[model samples]
Target: MKPVNIGFNNMVMDERIVAIINPDSAPSRRLREEAKLENRLIDATLGKKTKTLIITDSNHVIMSAINPETISLRIGKGE
Candidate 1:
């Protein structure tokens, strides 16, 4: 699997990513909370507000400050 940089030097495996969605909706927010409660939330925002949420196959949620579109581009590059 290729390693995709989410932002701020954080990287995630491209193959493991299930979905990347904006975290503004109620359901997304609830998912973030649930991930937090389950200890499966990874904050890669580095103190910044989360703009995107990366969901993994293992049910882990990764919070990122970068836009989802930009992350998608990086994943496409497969770098």
Candidate 2:
């Protein structure tokens, strides 16, 4: 699997990622809350403010401090 760096030394499998969203959005917030309730949330923010929410095909939600645009760029470059 190709892994892409999301930031702060964090990397996620590129193929498994279904969506990268801004954390401030209402839908994203709800998604996070649901993921938390389902125990499918993975905190990758490392105590920093969350900038992006990564939704995976396996139903895992990852919080990242890095912006979604930056992560998209990394994915575009296949890094």
Candidate 3:
């Protein structure tokens, strides 16, 4: 994986984003579209540099980190 240097703003930017989609959720068309957009960004930018993404939900926690060639995730339940 290639190394990179990500800044704090980038992480802050992503904190405002969420990337999960459960086809059954009752979101407005616009919110659904926005989720799709965030999902795309997650796929494209998730694990860059030493940057890691932390996502939490009511029942789970997901941690994601990446390098130029590798993307990894760790999941746990409030443990």
lDDT to native, each model: 0.96, 0.93, 0.31
Question: Which prediction has the highest lDDT against the true structure?
Answer: 1
What TM-score number comes out for model 2?
A: 0.94
Candidate 3 residue pairs in clash (backbone atoms < 3 Å)? 47-66
Can you tell me which runs of candidate 1 are displaced by over 4 Å?
A: none
> Tens digit of lDDT per residue, candidate 3, span 1-79?
2222223223222233234332233453344355456653232344443233323332122223333122222111110
For lDDT, candidate 1 versus 2, the one ahead is 1
User: With candidate 3 superimposed using the best TM-score fit, by how many Å does residue 64's alpha carbon deviate from the native?
Assistant: 13
> TM-scores of all models?
0.97, 0.94, 0.19
lDDT tens readout by residue for model 2, 1-79: 7899988888999999999999897998999999999999999888999999999999999999998899999999999
RMSD of 3: 11.0
The best-first sequence of candidates by lDDT reads: 1, 2, 3
The order by descending TM-score is: 1, 2, 3
Model 2, position 33, has a per-residue lDDT of 98
lDDT of 1 by residue, 1-79 (tens): 9999998999999999999999999999999999999999999999999999999999999999999999999998876
